[model samples]
Target: MGGIVLVNVPTSKPLPIMTDTLQPMLRMLWFLLHGILPLAAEATYLIATYYSDDVCSSSYAYQVHAVDVVNCTSLTCSNGEMSSTSRSGDVESTECSTDYVANMTSTLSDSSYIIVLRFEDNNCSTLYYGYGTTELGECVENKYQGGYSISTLNKDGSADLEHFTDSSCSVAYASETANSSAVATHECSSSKYVWYTGSAQEFASNSNGDAGTSFSSDGDVGTSSLGSSHNMNRGGEYDFPPPSRDSSSSDARALTLVSVVFSCIVFVLVAVIIVLYRRLNRQTPVETRSGLWDDDTITATRIPRTKISIKKLLCRGAFGEVYSGVFNRQQVAVKMLLPATRSNLQHVNEFLTEAKMTAMMDHPHIVYYVGVAWDSLSDLCVVLEFMEGGDLRTLLNKYEAERHPVGIDRQKATIALHICHALTYLHSLSSPVIHRDLKSRNVLLNHSMTAKLTDFGISRERLDRTMTAGVGTSLWMAPEVMLGERYGVKADIFSLGVVLSELDVHTLPYAQVKKQCRETEGPRARLWS
Candidate 1:
């Protein structure tokens, strides 16, 4: 009866709709319009305007200030009595009859005007205009000397200032009352505008461009004069107003910044994943072929790291080719089996049998089967093991060439000792075993001349004192077996004796045995008596 084998074939699944090409196309579009280039341009524009000498240059740097106002109902206190505290830990106050709510200053220049207003965290909404004055000559020498200052709000209520200019501004103020605070009915005037000549001395000395009043008869503020403001309902107590939006380019700027940050995070994550994958594969078990083609393609059935990577073929045989390689950080030889010879059942059986049988044994003289991996895709793999020296046949030929050759006396004794140990173990099996084709080529060696018997494909097991396999190399056959006679363990002893006789004459026992067996007569010689 034949042994059973189970084959697992993978099922076919449908491929995804989004192919490889489409992914790159989408990425390219994202880079072109929304990536680093756009972000860089936006940053450059913002920096140039922010560093410009005319507007509030101090606005570019954020700072904190707190103002404590006691018993104040309106922001119209002229006595300047409110206490002011700054992030620098400086506090200032003055004696006055009335207290004002708050005052924080971002000085544009010595004489330039500042417009202070609070912005919502959304960056697109404003709560309400708290207090601001562009009043020209009334500019305080030290902006916080009056002791009234605006307290720094949290991220939800931070303030930013924008310069009202001839080229840029039209001022519109909106107010809301919250927390039952009473509105002051005093007729408040709008802030003034003036041209500051970049110096305290110049600003103080010159009276030319300072405005006498808030706006001369409410004339359009700038040359274009198309500025507009709108209010939206928010919680009924507070009104939300649209921020001074930076004209259509703000979205482009913000989107570009986000994309660049996202891309960089993805790139770093991919690099880490690749490193971990390499480490995992190196530590995985070895069960594959281990050879490399001349074209740099590796053909390894097993994974083995050697001192040096192999790059050439050494020899070929019925099983496959053997290649030079390294193993365990030492110079060793690797045998890579060819694909299964499915046309010949015996060859396939030999290959399968070698892997199964040797995988169980672990001895220095016996060839080691490291492990095995089956590749369902290619249906082939290279088995790996250690090889110290070449086969015994190659070593003997080399010894013959050296002239200080291996003598028959030592050769026979050594071969007998090693073969005896291997066969004795195989024969003493619960069912006695036979090595159907034993030859010099099948005997391998190590650097210390240790011998190992291998190649047991055609071997059979005996049951109940009876064996019925007609197999074996003819030259090593016993005389009785050659005459169509059934034989048992005695046949193996007979073959060993023939091997022993060859050591005496330094000649092969069955050199003419095949020809003699065809003689149309009884057996001619007692070659294995």
Candidate 2:
């Protein structure tokens, strides 16, 4: 029998055992025939074969026997077992090896496209240990495994590469981007693992067949590559330094300090402003007093001292002088109490009472009380709407100067009617007002010759329709008022009648009474009567 030979065995099953006498004979027969037959190839080799797309399925396939690799145009081998050939045509192969690596690069016969494939096992069953590509710069399969078997597809161009020690690509050990025909290896000092340990190792390449390095865990290394000047140490270890902080960190710290300092300065300025405002408010005294009238009554407005500008003296009386002033840029009549009147508490109270009462009245025929103010010396001042036509007394005097007889009876009737309207409005109030003093002088005329009742100095709120004492011009006073009896709105009616007489007759009330007393030549009892 030809030399007993052991061949094609399966590792998953148990091997058949031979007797001691048979084993010696088989050993002797193998020694005798070893020189005669070609020595069995000790190392595994890669052979490229040809097939159609339907046979390969774009995946690695293997055969138990040697394949006719000469029919294939492209091939790659490890440990110098086989050599590479020029890649051309659609050279596909299903033959593969389980104990060695397979690398193939081929151009399609139908198109100008090229394909690259790498396998880790001879049978090419485990896809996790292989790499394949149809485009350049595109990711290679099974790149998570640290490997260095990267090359150009036809020596087209150079590539840049970086080797990371960790799966996350956070720890880089070597980097380069040069076209290398020979395989390059790298070792990590931290792990003591060689990056090119496996025959199936490969690097990602660009469209120009230039191999490059990837730094991210997802294998997107970007287009740009590192310089080829960087050396990839073979078997030697290298330490990767930690990242260092730049000047930007110092600039950020400086900016933070400036912001804090500026904020502190602003806080100090605000605090100072608040203190000054409080101090100024304290230094300025309050110029107004509240509760001058009943709670339910309309209150008078208080005018600031600076707002009143006395232009000239309009008139003067025993109580005070009236001055023409500009209040809030509008012409106003300001009546200031005399020093003598200010000295008397009764007169001062009466002045304030007049202001309060006038302010409450809203009738058109009643003079509008603008506001009240106080001088620097604390003297009371009352402001009223300026009547351009002056008082009825002045109007009558002008008529007499012009010899116009004060127009027709209609003019007198109108004046009387306006006065009556004002009186009616006062009496109709919830707290009826009593105008104790009613005369031609107290009736003011505006530019339109409209009559407005004024001078509320002696006016009082009379809800009971009675008063204890008589108060008014004696000539206009009624007989019952002169007798000091309790009177009511009837007293104001009597004053209104006297005012109407003055308007119609164009003469003062009881002017004839003074003349009669002066001309009296009879008994004293007649003068009394």
- Top candidate by lDDT: 2
Relative to the true structure, how large is the alpha-carbon lDDT of every model? 0.39, 0.51
lDDT of each residue in 1-529, candidate 1, tens digit only: 3532545546596323223333454465446545454344411000101111223244332222122222112221122211211223222222212111112222322322323333332332222222333332221112321212221111211122222101111211112211101111111222211111112222332334332112222221111100111111221111222123445546765676777757765764564455445554654434454322211212222443323355445554434555655555655555445322323345444555555555444455566554443333223333455446666555544544465433466755786688677777777777676665665556777767777876555666665474555566565777666765677777777766665554444435543353355354442111221
What is the Å distance of residue 106 in model 1 from its true position? 96
Cα lDDT tens digits, model 2, 431-510, are: 99899998888999988888999999888999675986778867688888899988998898998888777676565665
Error of 2 at 511 (Å): 1.8
For candidate 1, report its TM-score. 0.35
Per-model RMSD to reference: 40.5, 52.0
Please give me the total number of clashing residue pairs in predicted model 2: 9
TM-score of 2: 0.42
User: Using TM-score as the measure, which candidate wins?
Assistant: 2
Looking at model 1, residue 86 earns an lDDT score of 20
Clash totals for all candidate models: 14, 9
